[model samples]
Target: MQVQKFGIEALDNMLGGGLRSGRPYIISGNSGTGKTVLALRFLYEGLKMGEKCLYIATDKPPHSTITSISDSFGWDLLSLNVMDAVPTPSLYSTVYPVRDVTAKGEIREISEMSKNVEKGELTMESIILKLELEYKEKFYHRVVVDSFTTLKRFGVEEERRNPVMAKFFRFFVEKGSTVVLTVEGNIQKIRPELILSSGAIHLKREVQDMEEKRKIAVLKMRGSFFDPIEREFIIDKNGISIRKVKSK
Candidate 1:
């Protein structure tokens, strides 16, 4: 496996260099855990090295998300290519009548529609295929999927969801892109074992007396040796930094 720099010196050393190149990996954590910041930092590093970076966002508008990060981290967001397909209010309105339904019912219906959007009924595969055709020889080296938990809105039957997730993974691998996938920790119905059968890195964040802190651990990495211990991490203006947890 080719090693790619993670952009954090200590964490890079911990990985014996950096993340393995051309592999699909997960960065799981609850909201406010800095998963988005970490993933963006990884992609930004690639962009700095002249590697084409692709960001696939499922939750927020891609431009808005990039703009927010660019403002905070000082990365030239315009340099990286972003592809996003998220559930839209108009799309939801088309699927179900929001005004007539109860609030809970409306939420449930919209959620289902959003999952369908992510599953590629909204043309995610077609968009990706087009990107692959255009960038195959361009040597695009980094890819990030903002969150995978959105797929659960389609329903928890693995039979329905796994195939879509698997297809997306296959596309990324075929393109030989280093990919990072994000997932919210509270929702476990989709099962990391299913989505991350290829590999994963789990990130957890906790707040102690209003100060936020993070923990990083590798749940799985197919062909590389990595430290499995959960360690502390911080997100500053520059990006994410990880520190080894000292044993008590």
Candidate 2:
């Protein structure tokens, strides 16, 4: 089986070298636990390997929000294909063009998908359609969706979340892309995507010895052996790096 590296050396080792490729995985954590950073780092690894990568920015606007975050980390994200699916104000037209930040640092509008998008809203259905069109032309080796939490709140109706996400993952696998989706919450909060994912890496903030610490753990990985230990990590000038595994 092929594998995908997380780009964090110790984490790669914890997953027994790397995660299995061509499968969907979830990065679940509460706010301030480095979910977005970890997701971007995973894509950075793909970039280093010279693989085609895509980032779906659903939590915030891609132009300013994502670029600013990447800039702070000193990671040039120009080479990564980014789809701006962030919801716009209802005052805007629903028939807006689907745009992407191309490699040349320019926003290029793609084909129009609809004339009536329900108050110019970006919905789960439209996002899936855009992805389908994207895959038909060029395939991405790795794809990251910033946070499912925001998408859940605005993109889809609550009742249809499961089947829609299941379809999303199914299409993702069929395209042979290794996916990492960020979810804002804990492993205890059961979600449809978590169950649909091939594996899940959880991040959390814990207080030990009177200091708050960041930790990462692989809750479950199908068809693979993992360290099964919660490990300490830190985010600094170089982004997320494992410090040490928790003592058993």
Candidate 3:
């Protein structure tokens, strides 16, 4: 099976060289676990490989949001194609993204789903249609949905959101792209999308030795033999750097 490396050398090695192509995978974790950074780095890898990459900014401000973050990391990704789907907060049309927590433990408020979205605003269906149309014009080999947690805030109710996402993943796979999605919570939840995803990778964080550290683990990968052991990772100005845990 063809694979697309995440470009984090240690991580790529853990997943048997890279993630299987034409698959959707989840980067599951809570806030401050480097989910967004990992997603960006994944797309950066695609850019380096000369593949067409697309980033759907559901959580951040817009194209500039990614650009600013990339610049801080010294990761040159200004050439990436990005779209801002973050809805403007209005009485009837509140934006998605359940919430956000800073590394320093600051909490950001999230708006509830719109009971009635205003004109010229984006909805869950609209986002899906936009992606479909864009892909038809020119298929992107790599795609990143900043966080599914934000997407979850799309519909007014769970019943409405679940089926739509299931279909979305089907469409995503049919396009033959390597897609990465981030989630704000545990991966074992009964989210319907996980059932259709080709794999699921989780980032776990714990405070030890008076500092916080992350462990990257593969929950399940359909077409590859992945090391299940959780490995340590460091996120700094340079971006994510991973190291396998020594076996005891």
Candidate 4:
């Protein structure tokens, strides 16, 4: 497996070198835990190495998300193929149809329609196919899906969606791309059907005496060794930086 550097010495050392190639890893955390920042750093590092990077955002528009982060770093995120998976107003009804039992008979209808609801709007499998075709020989080493939680908002049950997540994971793994997916830990604990499909790492915020601190720890890695300690990390102008926590 090819190891990709994160541009942070302590973090690189913790993983024996860096993230392994062709593996799907989850970065779970709550809001303000710097999950998005971590993903950007991973892509930025890959871009520095001349590897193509793709960032798929389901929650916010790609431009807005990129603009907010690009000012903090020197990375040219616009140069890369950034896509917004949010559905347009016109295609919402056709893409997502909900079955409803009215007085007449059972009828399928689009419920709570909105341009922002992307639940059944985009397919991860289709996105991968498009990327493969666009970046044919360039070799895209890194791919980031901003948040899987947003993708699940389309009313698909966990049991039904697990297969989709699994297929998406396999698609990238087979293509030899290091994929990073952000997930909400609290939500995953409640509905864990997708947990079985990929390796997971939990990022938690520790509050002590009203002060908050962030920590990153590996919950599981499919077929490789990972540091067991919950390392402290920070998101600043440059991006995410991690340091090992001393053992007591």
State which candidate has the highest lDDT. Answer: 2
- Residue 167, candidate 3: how far off, in angstroms? 0.7
RMSD over all Cα atoms, model 2: 4.6
Between candidates 3 and 4, name the one with more favorable TM-score.
3
What's the TM-score of each model vs. the native?
A: 0.75, 0.86, 0.83, 0.77
lDDT of 4 at 114: 34
What candidate 1 gets wrong by more than 4 Å, as runs, is: 89-133, 136-139, 151-158, 186-197, 207-212
Better model by TM-score: candidate 1 vs candidate 2: 2
lDDT of 2: 0.76
In terms of TM-score, how similar is model 4 to the real structure? 0.77
- Candidate 4 whole-model C-alpha lDDT, 0 to 1: 0.65
TM-score of 3: 0.83
| Local accuracy of candidate 3 as per-residue lDDT tens digits, 40-95 | 88988888999988877777665455656677788767567765566653221112
Cα lDDT over the full model 3: 0.73
Candidate 2 lDDT by residue in tens digits, 25-86: 99999888988888988988898899998888777766665565676788766687777666
Off by over 4 Å in 4: 88-120, 125-138, 155-158, 187-198
The model with the greatest TM-score is: 2
Q: How well does candidate 1 match the true structure in TM-score terms?
A: 0.75
Ranking by TM-score: 2, 3, 4, 1
